[model samples]
Target: MLKQLSVAVLTAAGLLLPAAADASPARFLDQSTIPDLQRAMDRRQLTSEQLTRGYLRRIEELNPRLHAVVQTNPDALAAAKESDTRRRTHSSRSPLEGIPVLLKENTDTADRQTTTAGSTAMLGSRPAKDAFLVQRLRSAGAVVLGKANLSEWSNFRSTAQIPGWSGVAGQTRNPYALDRSPCGSSSGSAVAAAAGLATVAIGTETDGSIVCPAAATSTVGVKTSLGVVSRGGVVPITAQHDTPGPIARNVTDAALTLSVLAGADPADPASAAATFPKDLRLDRNALRGKRIGVWRKGHTGIDQQSDRIFESTVHTLRSLGATVVDGADVEDISWSVKPDLLPALLTEFKHDLNAYLAATPGDHPRNLSELIAYNDQHRDVEMPLFDQNLFVEANATDGNLNDQAYRRHRAAATGIAQRSIDDVLASNGLDAIVTLSGLPASPLDRPGDPRFLSSTRNTSVAGYPNITVPAGFAGPLPVGISFLGTKYHDAQLLSFAYAYEQATHARQAPRYLPAATG
Candidate 1:
């Protein structure tokens, strides 16, 4: 009788509450930030093992429906135990001393998890070694919980592809609304962090991968300036634009991840200029009395609801003492880049892919030719939507990355984007730019996203930094506002974003429903 009474008490507390919980819905743990978790660990309120067990158990119960996680580390528990030992020994390393972090599949992890980049062709493939940025993560004492599924080859595999579908990991369901899209190719990392699968996750972006998924999942993600975070060992779409960044449940945590991930690396030449931008926490209130340029274009494709939400975001920023200067006023602002974007992407894809394939493990169609042939053989599965259009177009190009045409296009596109985007900020005496993130990615029921118009493109094509914080929700699902800026302004960028996020406090956990559309 006494034991039965004790069991009932535990049930009311929401401690997983048995198979048929008699209490309210799973309250889970406190579901807070990395710093909060670290303080709790410091006070012995929670052990790393306890925290990790809760996450693993939540995955066992919830991921069957969400499909947000692609793989789990077999050593996760053992790592958690080691973290506990280190804590007891008074040797805590950093804020993430015992926190679990998930890495996008494209980021190499020299471990049990395979870096397949969410494609079956690379199934069983493992990266030759840990990517430089990934190695930095390990040094900060983060337990590698697992790898998050991403859009195949970071969404470079197909032109008319679904946002979250990948042959290796399948379609990761949107945690906020099951049938709705999570957006990608950082879909898994964003969703995993939003759904409490881990404290934070690292995601890569050549374009919209980080911001889109963050907006879709009610989290914060920073798409750092080129070279701020080393791109070595990460699967690439364009070496000129590719970068890895952080996705977390909140802006502060994302800022923390940014600090650890940014550094100079001998492996990636781009890192020569990346010796800074790791001090995001230094200026915690960068938004005070600062000028922020409001982007004039790229919100036209948004839904009506997101427009209203964006207006509120502007008001919120203004109230925080930011001078909101409007328009795309700059030198060469009219100069466009997409005319050469496809050519540059294709050329880089072929060269970079061949290098990555040679480095990683696998036994399947490799190289641009073999992959094209493989796509031809599996047309029903691979080409049901988009033809191997990119593959074919790329096949027609020169393998020479230094060809005159390739070099010219690369120079023109990157120059116009970088110069104009920065000129707008400089001319306005602005520290950053603000814009609606995009149409809160239309539902996932269809084959593709609803012709989404994202502002991250400018920063992406320009190789500048951009971050998205939870602006607020249109309904039950979340939306984000982007902060974009000049070259290597990663610290200033994070400070502005973190201040905005703290002021708004506008994040919530996903309800894991069907669709939030009205």
Candidate 2:
């Protein structure tokens, strides 16, 4: 079993100060999202450099305890200076000009920072280029503040892998409860946003990596339809499923980021069909007269507290003039827990990862086999918590995209996932479907049982759009409600989520409690 670090060990690297900050910037920066920060810059109340330094200081003072951020960009202040210059010259690049953002470590940056995906194996080497979305953010004048810690190898390393554990950066703790799991592979991205380390963050998901953690940490996560954002520079799980999206404190901020991050790229053919909406402004009345499918069957027995919040959310939707249709499920899509999904993921992981390694300019392991061997050689550091059995399985798979079985399973997965949502929407004539994001953060002391239900599975498998907005509290922890829609419905999903968010105003800034106690 993986050993849990003691409170002393957890706080050894830094002071365990209360999450409340008394710093001058905390008043202006603590709970500020993108628009709030932008307005502060526009009013000349804050400079890009000042804002960047405030976040850097927060990361330095607090990251030791939470381990939410892995490293700060050495030239972050310099980037912010450039943004200040642009703003002074009346030549701002985009709406995101001068805003700070933290990216999940899996995203590459051609700078002093290394993109290791929380693994030491890829350390000491810089990527030859920035990820496609990173380039977009830089072009929009966003300061690349730092990299956030995540589950090593995006939580695909071990079948028993813990959500926030990483060899490179021990573990990322929930801002709400330091001892709880930050439920996604994009743990750091969620934590960083919730802790006010950045105005926004970017996270990639093959499935629950984005929304799950966003839910657990009380932040907004958008899992754009596959190819809505390019997967070119991200480490892969499967080309069919991997896509990068934004995580922020609100739907408008997430939507704004998506507008900047989405577009076609030559490197990823899937983006050819991608389309983006120009207007991201949220209409608070967007839910009016909307027919919403409430999928309550999945989350009933797992957590009563979350279920109560879900029921309350359904009531809120009805009060907002939505016609809530109960009992909507994708019974046709049985791939969620089936054995066939693993083979498809394994086959694609080997093929896509090999291509990525070959293209990256480094002396790192060139493929899955070499990576597995690297882990075996460095067992003390790499395999202390859990072994790389998932890597082993992927390495053993016949890495052929053209193989008949591979093609069949991959096609079947996509088709089934798509049809599942399409049929539900068509039959019920629903605008969007709602469900609990997942269970609140689990305890990190041991290998916990798998969650019985998750809203991410159906939409993830179908390559459709999904958005998570903080619903309410499950006791001391946060819970989120998800909105799922058919493929290419990202804009509508965002609009709907935005409406609910504006009405409820449920998200709360984390208290950074030491641990739960009676």
Candidate 3:
């Protein structure tokens, strides 16, 4: 009860007095996720039409200024109409049957909306049908609320770039601190979830895309192991690193989204291990006496602000009866992984993306070389804020995925990361490792690019599961702490997060701001 009261107090105060504190219609409406809203609908308070209209109204009032939502599905109202029809005529829903959700624009919706990937090159093209993820959402009765704005090409188009800027969708401001940035490429998806534009939003991550944006936006984000969630129809990044995860205001919402979207899809070959656990919502005492190893390296020298917040989080976890064991540095953490990281990404990007693009024929550049050439051709709009240095470099590399050098590099990289994780857990008999999820929030854009260290690689290279929960604030900007562990430890990590959340309940909703200041 104390924890619940704290969450309510924090939510109320934070929503009303958020960093930057910009008013948003989206934040004012019934912004709960599908499950919470479903309960309200069941109580005969908000009909599906009313729910849909509220979000539409929010989108209308804010999208123009914030540029968070670009293309709302034309069929959204009709879909809501259908949901209302069912509610009045029938008795129950098929899970999220009437829930309105925003797809990250990278997700193919197969509706009137086109998946532009926030780029002008594919602005007008529409997929022949819904992407597999969208199809899953539809299968569970979710309304394709709209296509959200995202970092163009999911942030693969440029290097050292701004977070929320897109050629087609313009710039999506941080809902809490507009000047501070919402981080990307899942910027719009996380913002939509935070500002009440949608109940839930789906964001794809290659490196820090999903988790960074979620931390910056004060939402819950899960970055599954490489093959856990299907990457079937989502836009391509490095196939070895990409997974579409859930971003929501709470862990339960995220878990619920994961449950709805999990399972095997023949379309995405990597999703074979997508089996979810039964009874995902664990008890509040799940973390008592559980081993929690502290990852000290990831947080040692980042932001002074984030470090202070993470300290509070560690203290909180210890107070809740969790056995806290500190330290992550060892001979193996990144011993020889640094030299081989870029080569692997370049090789995988060129190989996997080409394969995925061949399936989706379009007028835009279809391959890595072509994309680099296209950027060279039109460097003005695409390279105005940042250069395509990463793409150009990757395009120049040889993708010898089958060669001796590639094999050695991949082996060494994974070996170091995985060994470090194992050493930490095994030495301490730990269930999960906790660390600062790190706010990769947007720095103020200027003549140069906004810069920050990428934190996703620590677990990504290891092929581990990671979950981020809201920890506390760094000057009103949200920072999160993570619980991660060895391969296929999704349930264990979730339970740890749930217990921490139940104890701390630290998350607060965003109040869209035009700028940030005390």
Candidate 4:
């Protein structure tokens, strides 16, 4: 199955070139952050068109092996030329000017590329307008490089589906180790960012989608407080927990990207009630005199190497002038029980997805029921590996957000999650809670992989901000530590993450090894 998938992806990418032609021209792009690229452009040492073409060339050379990018923007060079013109006129829009960014396939761009969420069912579903976040990136003079492949329907399609597999694009391989999972459903975004396919990428997360992939690929992922970044035209998984955030090679790039994306949108009601921080500048001394709480409940005793690395991280934090509080776990919440989350997601997925399909101008399934039928009809293409049981369950729901049972379940889940994080913070008098973002990537194509462990659910359910940075490596695989903060505290969390990232500098460019190394 893996071999076949690899061939299919290579064929789909049209990467059957000679050995000489396969050599990448953008080796300098490796581990390059947005600020570094901006400075080069500012010094007239580089043009946006040059940077954009370099990335495009890299994607053409490497994407066949990693399957990170599913589509390349036809107008990307033109947009870069426009950015170059603006710079020539001394009218740069923002720090992101002339930077190339990859958008997760689920993000709507209203361009030549299709926003299919990596599913064949929505193959032609081109949204009428760009997602609010995409509009923000464009207005900031960022070039839309392409759409990165993702787990089909952002991993909401089935319970037994593979993490990075999709009907539209085959599996996305981890750049660090091709045989290991890239994690999902933001798999391609993180893989691309880690491999320098782009300067930065935007990924949406309902739960661990963004952070898990980022952690697995040794990149920085910021899952903003739900309303901090608008989800206006992005494909939905439940508006209550869905958000589009940045996945970059470093914390500063993620924070800078978030500043551009954070704004209220009248189209999304959730954004209206949220207050975005105006100043997103990070202070290297942000951790000094700050109380940081360590939540090691699920992180410890799992992997000895990870535990040792985390202990070192805690020591580093204390040495950097932080007051580290041990045993500040969110004891009120039970990780074993999630009675309301599934049903609530099913109800909300049905309701929200229907609305998104109806609003999108395209010839595709218009609702959950139609989507299920479409999958059923095209079983060979859509469900060859796993059945769409989640879609069937969602379709069974009444698709009403106003249903009493759904509303009650949603409220209970959100309340418990909020209290879990909030109570711990308040009782400990800490600025943020830190834990392992996720375990290292398991082997790809293993359906019931037990090595996966997630620590993003509480923050995801509470609709708060969470940022994950590379803490260390286990063998050739990367481990990330997450800093979770209360709602609307996105800026503060980024500052803390930035400070930690600068001190440790743990992230490394991927080597694209065939397997993990000791």
lDDT of each: 0.77, 0.84, 0.73, 0.86
RMSD of each: 4.0, 6.2, 4.8, 6.0
Off by over 4 Å in 3: 1-33, 89-94, 298-305, 328-335, 398-400, 439-442, 446-454
Which ranges in model 2 have alpha carbons more than 4 Å from their true place?
A: 1-27, 332-337, 447-451
Better of 1 and 2 by TM-score: 2
**Top lDDT prediction, candidate number:** 4
User: 2 or 4: which has the higher lDDT?
Assistant: 4
- Tens digit of per-residue lDDT, candidate 1, span 216-256: 88888889888888888888777888989999977778878
Candidates in descending lDDT order = 4, 2, 1, 3
Instruction: State the lDDT of candidate 4 residue by residue for 98-157, as single tens digits.
Output: 889999999998889999999898887978999999999999999999999999999998
Candidate 3 RMSD to the correct structure: 4.8
Flag clash pairs in model 4: none
Off by over 4 Å in 1: 1-31, 277-279, 282-284, 300-302, 328-335, 379-386, 446-452
| Candidate 1: Cα lDDT at 398 | 74
lDDT of 3 at 498: 75
1 or 2, greater by lDDT:
2
Better of 3 and 4 by lDDT: 4
Model 1: how far is 499 from its true place, Å? 1.2
